[model samples]
Target: MAHHTLRLRVRRITPEAEGILSYELVASDGGRLPPFEAGSHLDVHVPGGFLRQYSLCNDPEDTRHRYVIAVQRDDHGRGGSRAMHELVREGDVLTTSYPRCDFPLLYARSYVLVAGGIGITPLLSMAYVLRRQRVPWHLHYCTRSPERTAFRSRLVSSFAGRVTFHHDQGDPSQGLDVKALLATRTGGTRLYCCGPAGLMRSVREAAILHQWPREKVHFEAFSAEATGAITDRADTEFQVVVRSTGATFPVPPGRTVLNVLRANGMRVPSDCEAGSCGTCLTRVLEGEPDHRDSFLPEPQRTTCRNMLVCVSRARSRKLVLDL
Candidate 1:
């Protein structure tokens, strides 16, 4: 889909916790905002020419008023959150993409929702939808302490018994036991987790060791870590052939297939360049893909039918894409 660029006025900005700020966005003309699903996110273009994605935290049923999002300042990040915290203010007009959801709540008998830090934004919306549908669900939110937790009071008061808090308090040893939690119920339950790399790795490892069905496990990683073959691959040049135009482009070392295409005037949709979001997914008409993205499942990656061009590279000498 083409990126939908719209001007939204920042209606309100409030500090929800330490280093965290919540912003309410609405139409500049006071018209109704676009409708979005429970787990949808908006790609907001802040200063520094960067587009950052933030989850929609408000109730999905109420779409007439405003869209809410929380930003946690990551001093070590790519200046996305820092810009929102330091530069953005109320009444400022911001350009943003329409709402899109890659991590959606699926049908299940029961659900186990896990979140860490700002990752709770999307899951919080899922909780509201689940509650209205009367579906069985549980939420486990982990943070450093009470002072660092966002929306703590509302979560505790609204969900109450369904929510669980795990605070590390600067101690790694005191963190939640992921293995024990996964070991309790392995059947008839779907697990959804979004958080820091460490927390996500723990959950993934536990699920793998417990032989959990692949379909039952779901995750959405907002950041890309440099520990995988994506960074270790020998930088080599490849070629991309656009099927419609019969044109070929050279993908030089140190660049992605998507970058090569866009630099050559081909417009491709992309959200999180980390490959976590499937926005840049393109059909692989021919050629093997060196699948480094975490979005596609192992089975689909094995088929070589499609690839997320933002981060994934070609394994063969040339790749034919349905551009």
Candidate 2:
């Protein structure tokens, strides 16, 4: 389906920075928001910066007047989070894409959800769905410190027993026991995790080492950027042949293939340009896809088939693009 932009009024901007600040807004169209699943995320467009995805924290079944998003100001951010934390206000209007998500919740007799920092946004919805359905689930929210965490009060008040809050900044010993948790989980259980790439990687490795089914463990990252090392080593002089357009361009040593294509007037849909979302995914007809994006399954990378143009590149000469 063609993507349609929505003019959503900033109905609410709640911040959980050592406390809570309720900033409510209304729908510009005064209509019901699009129906989305438990893990769906909304793409908030902050111009001159990036289009970052935020999970719909409010109940999807709630035909409320408008939508809700909770954001915490991050200091070392590249604009989106800071913009959302500082610039966004109640009643302000902004255009955003409908909810899109990679971490889909599945049927599991029991669930183990792990969230790190702002990664709690999506997990919030998952917990909400599970609670409403009376499904058994628990959350392990890991934050740098309690001072920077969002939605602290509500998460505790509502899910006192079902949730476990961990402040990694204060003490590492209080960290969530992923190894033990995964080991004790029943067979029909599924695990969902969202947070830092390091945590996700560690969880995946531990689960694999424990022989957990890869398909049963689902995760998504809030932000991921290409390391300067990878972005610097490659020469940007390779030829990218658009099989359909028969056009070529010089991708600068530090520029992404997606940027070059967009500069040349190609209409490519992208969100969280950090290669987190599969939004910029393109089928690879030939050549090896550098495959930097975490969106691709580990096994599929061998095929070197699909590529996320937003932040990935080619390891060989003569890259053929299906665009």
Candidate 3:
């Protein structure tokens, strides 16, 4: 899954509620693009010029238009959201990669969709796909307020009674009615959730407490993997040995190992640069990885032996990475 650079050409900004912005993009050739499934996401080049991922909320089948990504003005970070809000506009192109999604929904009999705030990006496509296929499902969308939600009217009118909207008036105490929702279980249903860390943690715990099958409980983290502190690495160029091609390259400074590989014409599949999604997980043959990602747990990461090369930097100077 190599990332393809695409340019955003047009945007429709709605500042009324939650600030919805629709982006129109085309491939490098400015032609019809390849097909993508529901829940597919692309690694978009952020405005300030770092790679961040965003899910495609538009209909996957519609190729005439590229995407409709909603960005809320996040007060955090060095201003990616603020730049997206202020700078990105019609005909002013920005670099975005082709679709690469980690959370592909395996076929299930029924689905219970849950979306929180900007977490609605992935689930909205799934909900639409389920309805188009006439699958048995329902969606629960929870946001801080109606003003903070992106597609409020569209969800209500189009989804009708199949969706439930819960607007919390900025109160942390007024949580979702999770106990009532999960009180009864659908025997053949798979629950899909993408939201804040708290929502995901709570949902997973309750689902496990209710004895939901480990396989049936599916989720995708909206945020990236947070590695605490990187080790004091030497100023030597690390060698990343490509497993498939049997080639080696010197790791560059001031750029991620992934960036070095991409610059060398290698199309490595990567979406979230934060290492949470396991998109860039590669086998580490010989060196000890200073593991710092959230996805790989102690019991499992002990076997990685496979390491995520995105944010997890090299421990040793001449360390090897399986591309």
The lDDT of each candidate is 0.80, 0.69, 0.68
User: Could you say which candidate leads in lDDT?
Assistant: 1
For residues 1-323, could you state the per-residue lDDT of candidate 3 as single tens digits? Answer: 24346666554555535554655565545667767788787666666554456677877877565676666666553355666778777667666666766677778888898888788888988878888888889988888888888788888888898888888787745858775677678778988888775566667767867888877877765534213322333223467777778777777432356777787898878644555567788778777665656558777655657777765556665556555
| Root-mean-square deviation of every model | 8.0, 8.0, 6.8
Give the poorly placed runs of model 1, Cα more than 4 Å off.
Answer: 223-323
Instruction: State the lDDT of candidate 2 residue by residue for 1-323, as single tens digits.
Output: 11577788876665566533433435597987777777776666654445555666666676356566665555554455556666777778877776665567888888989887767878888888899888788898888777777788889888889988777775645676667767766778888887766566667767877888866878765642211112223233466789897897766444468778987999888754555557789987777766666667778778657888876767777688898
**Model 3 steric clash pairs:** none
- The parts of candidate 2 lying over 4 Å away from their true place are 18-25, 170-174, 224-323
Could you tell me the TM-score of candidate 3? 0.72
Judging by TM-score against the true structure, name the best candidate: 1
**lDDT at residue 126 of model 2 (Cα atoms):** 83
Superposed on all Cα atoms, model 3 deviates from the true structure by an RMSD in Å of 6.8
Clashing pairs in 2: 11-24, 11-25, 12-25
